[model samples]
Target: MLACLLLAQLLVAFIGRSVGPLGVLIGEDLELSKSQIGMLPAALFLGQAIASIPVGFVVDQTGSKTLLLLISLCVGSSFILMTFSHQFGFVLFLVVIGGLGYGAMHPVTNRGIIHWFQRTQRGFAMGIKQTGITTGSALAGLVLLPLAAMYGWRQVVAAACLLLIMGGVVSYTFYHDSIKETNQDKKNLASFYGSMKHMVRNKPLMLVSISAMGLSGSQLCLVTYIVIYCYEYLDISLFLSGVLLVISEICGSIGRIVWGIISDRLFKGKRVIILMIISGIAGVTSMILAFLPPSTTFGVMIPITMVFGFAISGFNAIWMNVASEVVDTTFSGLSSGFSITLGSLGVITLPPLFGFIVDFFGSFTAGWIMIVGVMILVFMLLLLLLLEIKTRAAY
Candidate 1:
């Protein structure tokens, strides 16, 4: 079941993340500005934000298997259809359709983990599951970019979507709901309004969710612009620039597992300290990026990108675990959904805003600074959350 969930996440995440490596191709073909290119991924996140709460509610009511199957087919078809469209608006529209499918992914997968794993093992389980995301993005950078360069982005997208459809079918065949629904369990399901109220009142969860907005936004900016930044600013080839994304993602994948182990084994289920450490690393890295010289070597950039990826990209597993654990197990999906919805707000807005700042200032420095500021704010929020936790323990 964990393997199936991971595979499903990997397939769906590919389409959304493909925008990063394929941005230059799409922009040149469509005659899009940087801001417009940023909008493509933002649109995807918008779909996610729109669908998250509703999907969360549905996943908690139904099981994850059915929803996972539906999203795979539906999102795969949407991206396949997207390949047929030449107009930017039409392509963006289809991306949103694909994003709607993605919105349900977290709620479904997190619910599965909550059902299958005990708290002692959940951080590592969630980490392994979250690696699917980084691995998918790495695949995009490693495989899709080269294919798009050789065969055109449209062909690559269509081919990938087909695989996604097949993966969905396979996952549906093997994955079953771990938790059987009883009459009592069904009866205890809260109304949507009641669930929202409970989630909103979860002070630590709410703080974490709000802080995540910054992290999500900063992470997206890194993914969206790093290729372009390397190519244009650092005088790297497009292929090599894409390789940098692959490196970050691969490191991010490793970081997810390491951080999870730290939380689960070393910290004994503690997550906020991990979050604060991640925030600090991300902030420092962003500061380096803000002041990076054009003459900086590719070797220097590699380590910096690795650290950035380790924090901004790798923090999700810990964040998701914290969010789900704060609420009742029955409402885990709802809590995950709510956190994602808030996180998506940052994902939706930050990339384009980063682009706009770049365009306005004619430099990446301000944009990196913006990300740095966001990380600082996230660290402060985590500090407050830690204080709150201590206060409650004292009481």
Candidate 2:
């Protein structure tokens, strides 16, 4: 099941990350300003945001395996449609479609993995799955950039679609999860609301929501801008930038699986406090390096940034894990749905916010500062959860 989840992760990454490379092509060919380039990313996130609530309900009604197969097709077709997108508006439309397809994975995939893996092994299980994002990013970095460089932009888009189709076929054939019996306690809508309201009223779901917001927002911010940042700020080649993203993602992928295993073994499957410390360290470390004087040495900045990526996703994988512990299993779909939906707001708001900052201030460094600032809560929340974990009754 972990192996299968890992493949889904790989496919999700492959399908989702073409935007960065696409943004580069669109900017050059379309004569876009930094602000204009944001439209595609903003569109993608917006699509994801739009579908966020709906996908959760879908997962609850059907099952994740079913949702995954459907999403793969939807997202794959969105990629195929992308090949015809010559104008900004056309691309914008496809971006939304692609984003919606991408967003479906979280609610569907997160719960499915939780259902598949036991508590003791979930960190590593989900970690291995998270590697799919990095793997896709790395593949895109290596393949998409060069395809755009040599064959032109359309080929790059076409290639992403091809990968998604293959993954979809595999998913349809192999991935299956028996529908869980809805809990006797969860039979009523009132009980469901009461359960979540309890989390909202008594626990730190809101705090976890804030953490998710920061992590998701900051990660997308980097994904949106890193290619442009490298070209504009670092004076590196596109191929080199792509390769760096791939390498960092590879490291991040390893970090996710390894950290999951570590958090479980060392902390005995209590995840919150452990990921918080890691996030804080990653946040601070990445901030320090982003400020260093720009030089050829800046080529090394990606690995530095990737440490933060590893930590952010580490905590992200577990937020739902912990939430599942707090809520009843019958409603894990709804809990994950709510968490991912609200968390997506960060992605929607931050990219354009950072874009405006760069447009006005004319410094990517300040944008980096804004991105790293999200980690401040990592320290605070970690301490909070650490204390909460001691009581084991906070949820």
Candidate 3:
């Protein structure tokens, strides 16, 4: 089941994250501005944000298997349709369709973990599962850009969508829900309202979710612009810049698994401390990028991108674990959904704003600085959350 869930996530993430690696190609083909290029991913996240909360409710009522299958078909079909798009507006519309499916992924997967894994094991399980995201992005960085360069962006997207569709079929055939729903487990509108009220009133959950807005925004910015920054500003070849993205994603995959182990074994399932550590690492890396010179060597970039990926790209697993655990197991999907909805806000807004800053300033420095400020905000919010957790324990 975990394997199937991971596969499904990987495929969906491939489609969702494809925009980052393909951004330059798409911009060149369509004659798009930086902010317009940024808007492509933002549209996808906007669709995701719109769908997350409602999908969370649906996941609780139904199960993940059906939703997982639907996500594959939805995202795959959307990307396939994008191959027909000649204009930026049409492509954005299709991307939004894909994002709607992307939104359901977390609620379904998080709920699956909550149902199947014990609390002691969930951090690691969630980490292993979340690596599907970075792995998918890595695959995109590794595969799609080269394929697009060789064949064409449209053909590559269409081919990838076909693979995603096949994976969905396999996931549906093998994966079954661990938890069985009974009459008593059924929820109504009143129950949803009650859940919403409870989540809103839950201070720790809210703080963590809000902090995720910054962390998530910063991560998206890194993914969206890092390639462009390397290629355009640092005078790296386009292929080498894509290689940098692949390296970052590979390191991110490693970070997710490593941090999960730390939370489960070393921290004994405490998530916030690890989050604080991630925030600090992310902040420091962003600071470095803000001042990174154009003449910097590829060798120098390697370690910097690796550590940056480890922190910024690696944070979601722990964050999702925290969101799911803070609420009732029954509402794990809803809590994850709510947190993602808030995080999606960051994903939607930050990339375009980061691009706009770069466009206006004619450099990537201010954009990197913006990410540094976001990390600082995340660090403070996590600190407050830690204090709240400690205070509650004291009482």
Candidate 4:
């Protein structure tokens, strides 16, 4: 089941990230400005944000496996349709459709982990599961970009569609819901609006969601622009820049596992405090990245980028786990849905903002500063969350 969930997430992530490394090529082909190119990811995230709450309600009615299967088909079909996109608007439309499919994986898969794993191991399990995101991004960095460079972008999308089809088959064959639904769950499902109302009233979950907005904004800026930053600003080749992205994602994958172990063993399930510490470290690294000397060597930049990736991208599973723990077990999917929807506000807004800063200033420095500032804001919010949790515990 864990493997199935990971595979499901990987497929969705692959579809979502396949365009980032190829951004330059696509922009050249389509004659798009940086801001317009940035809108591609924004449109995708907007679709996901639009779908998350409704999909959460659907997951509560159906199960993760069924939802996974349904979205897998949507993702596969969207990729194939992407092969025919000749205009920017059409591409954006396809990306939004793909994003809608990609949106449900978190709430669905995290809910699965909560059901399938024990409390003692849930952090670690979530950490392992969260690697699906980094893994997918790494694959695109390592494989998709190279292939798209050799063939065309259309061929790359077609090839990705084939893999997504296989992923759909794997999901249908192996994935199963661990939770056995009760009659009471069925009765409660009828009051979906009440559940949404209660979710709005949960202060901790609301704070977590808001914190996610900041962290996600920074993280998206990093991932969406890292390749372009390296290639355009640092005088790196496209292929080497893609390699840097792969390295960052690899570090992010390791960071998730290591951070999860720390939360489980060292912190004894105090996830928010760990998040607070990691967010501080991440904010520091983002500031450092923004200050990298123009003559900096790839070796120096490599380590910084790795640290940034780990610190920025590693804590998501912990956040999801913390959100789940704050609410009733039955509301795990709904709470994560709220977090995802709210968190996606960053995704919907940040990339184009970053691009606009770069285009206006004619350099990446200001954009990088914006990203780091957001990280600092994220750290402050995490601190508040930690204080609130501690105060409630004292009561």
Candidate 5:
């Protein structure tokens, strides 16, 4: 069941990022500027951000299994709709609606995982589950560009619609909810509202949400720009750049699993501490990459990017673990969703802003510096969060 949920999320991520790998071709087809090309992802994040809170609330009220099936259908249908779009505006609209389905996955799927896994096993489980994003994105990076090159980008999207439908079918056929819990959830209509109020008032959850904004923003910039950055800055071939991006995602997939084990065993589930350490690593790596000259070999950059991938990509499941730790079970979905909503601001704004910086400065350096600034902020907040926890513990 967890695997099915993960597969569904992986497919959703593939759909969410469908525009990115093919950005160059899509841009040429639509006659778009760099900033406009960047807006494609921004629009998807925007739609997901808009839907996050409401979907979180819904997840708390209903069964995640049902929501997963429904959202999968929505996502699959949106991809089918996207193939018919002739204008950028229309594509953007479909992406936004598709994003609503994407938004539902985190809250619904994470809650479902939390329901089944014990606390001792959950970090690892969540880690494995979160890999769907990097794995799917990685697969898309490796597969989509070549397909677009051979068959045209529109046809690739049409093919994606079929895969997404399979995800929906798998979710409906195999995924099961806890019937007793679902019945209990229906009995407490007021608890759903109470959960919302609780999440807003919870200081730890709010801090995690704010931390997520920085982490997510920095990570989004990496995912959105790395291919183009390699093409324009390093003069790498588009196909090779896509391969490098795939390597990063594959490394990240491994990191997610490894970090989960470490958090569960070495740290004894001290996820926030792990988050702080990784944030520092991610910050330093971003700064290093930012200042690298065009002459730097891809060999050097590859290992550095692999490290960046390890640091940034590993903590996603940990953040959810941290959120689930702090909140009650009844509000777990709400807390996770709320944090993602706050975090989506980074995804929504950063890509275009990075592109604008690139356009204005005519280089990738300043945009990476922007990411470094966010990482610094993230580190400080995590430090403060840790200190506050210590102070409360001492009291």
Candidate 6:
């Protein structure tokens, strides 16, 4: 069951990022301008953001098992349909179809892991589970580009469909819908509204949610634009930079597990403090990398990117774990859903906005500064949250 759940997340990440490595290939094959190619990704994210909360609400109503089944079917179908796309709008539409599946997975999986794991072990377990996303993304980056290089984009899309079909079958046959309640339960609004009122009235958790939005915004912008920025602005080879991005994701995969284990044991439930510290480190490092001279190379930047990935990656579980504790249990799915949706606004606005900054200002410097600034603001909010926690406990 555990292994099956993990496979579900791996496939989730794969379907989510299926088109990214092929961005350059898709452009050449379709005779697309940079903006047109860029729109496909933006469309996917916009679609995902639109779908996430609704999926969560549905999961809260029906159950994650049904949602998981829907996700697998959607992924299988989306990839197959995408292969037939020949025009820009057609491709964009196809990508949005896949985005709907990817968006649905976020809340479903968050609630699923919460149901499956114990609170005491959730930090590490959820972190390990969430790494499935980076692992799948890293694999797609390694495989899809080369597959496109040899077999053409259509064959690659077909192959993705085959994998999704297999994964979907496994998810349906083995995944048990019966979940033991963890720290959260009660999916109804009688519960949800009450939980919302409680969470909103709690100052510390409110601060944590605010900090999470800022951190999420920064990470989304960084991940979405790093590829384009490196290729377009830094003049790095696309294939090589793609490989480096995969390596950084690999580091993130390991980092999530390592940090989770640390938080589970040594941090001893100090996850919020740890998150604040890590966000600050990522902020400082982002600024340094942004301002690096042209003399700096990809090799030097890989480790820096890895550090960014690590710090940023751990926050997903850390924030969700905190959400489980701070809010009324009934609302974890809804809270996770809404916070992730709020985070997706960065997804909606940041990438193209980053492109606009680069296109107009003629530098990634301004863009990086904006991203780094968000991280710093998140760090400050986390610090204030810590103070609020201390003050409340004192009473």
Task: Tell me how far the alpha carbon of residue 310 in candidate 2 is from the true structure, in angstroms, after superposition.
Answer: 3.1
Error (Å) of candidate 2 at residue 323 is: 3.5
| CA-lDDT, candidates in order | 0.90, 0.70, 0.91, 0.82, 0.83, 0.71
What digit string (tens of lDDT, one per residue) describes model 6 on residues 295-334? Answer: 6678877888788878775577687677666655555566
The sequence of per-residue lDDT tens digits that candidate 3 reaches over residues 356-393 is: 99999999999999998898899999999999999988
Ranking by lDDT: 3, 1, 5, 4, 6, 2
Candidate 2 residue runs with Cα over 4 Å from true position: 179-202, 388-395
Q: Residue pairs in steric clash, candidate 3?
A: none
Number of clashing pairs, model 3?
0
RMSD of each: 1.4, 2.8, 1.1, 1.5, 1.6, 3.0
lDDT of 4 by residue, 132-212 (tens): 988888888898888988898888878888898789789878988874522225525558889898889888888888988
Sliding window of 10 residues with minimal summed lDDT for model 2: 179-188
Cα lDDT of model 1 by residue, 1-395, tens digit: 99999999999888778987799888988999989999988988898998888888888887888888899987899989988888999999998998999878888898888888999899999999999888888899999998999899999999999999899998889998874422215424447788899899999989999999998888889999999999999998899999999999988888888999999999999899999999999999999999989998788899999999988999999999999988888888889999999999999999999999999999999999999899989999999999998898799
TM-score per prediction, in order, is: 0.97, 0.89, 0.98, 0.96, 0.96, 0.88
Predicted structure with the largest TM-score when compared to the true one = 3
Instruction: Rate residue 35 of model 4 by lDDT.
Output: 84
Q: Write the per-residue lDDT of candidate 2 for residues 1-395, one digit (tens) a residue.
A: 55655676678667677676557776888788777676666777777777765676556656766677778888888878877866878877887888887877777777777677677877877776777776777677777778888888777667777778787778767877754623223234555566556656635555666677777777667667777777777777777766666666666677677777877898788777766776676678657646766574544676675675566544556666665555666666666767677677887788778777888888788887886677786567656766765776545
Count of clashes in candidate 4: 0
Q: Best candidate, lDDT-wise?
A: 3
Model 1 RMSD vs true structure? 1.4
To one decimal, what is the Cα RMSD in angstroms of model 4 from the true structure? 1.5
**Clash count in backbone of candidate 6:** 0
TM-score for model 2?
A: 0.89
Score residue 164 of candidate 6 by CA lDDT: 74
On a 0 to 100 scale, what is the lDDT of residue 12 in model 2? 68
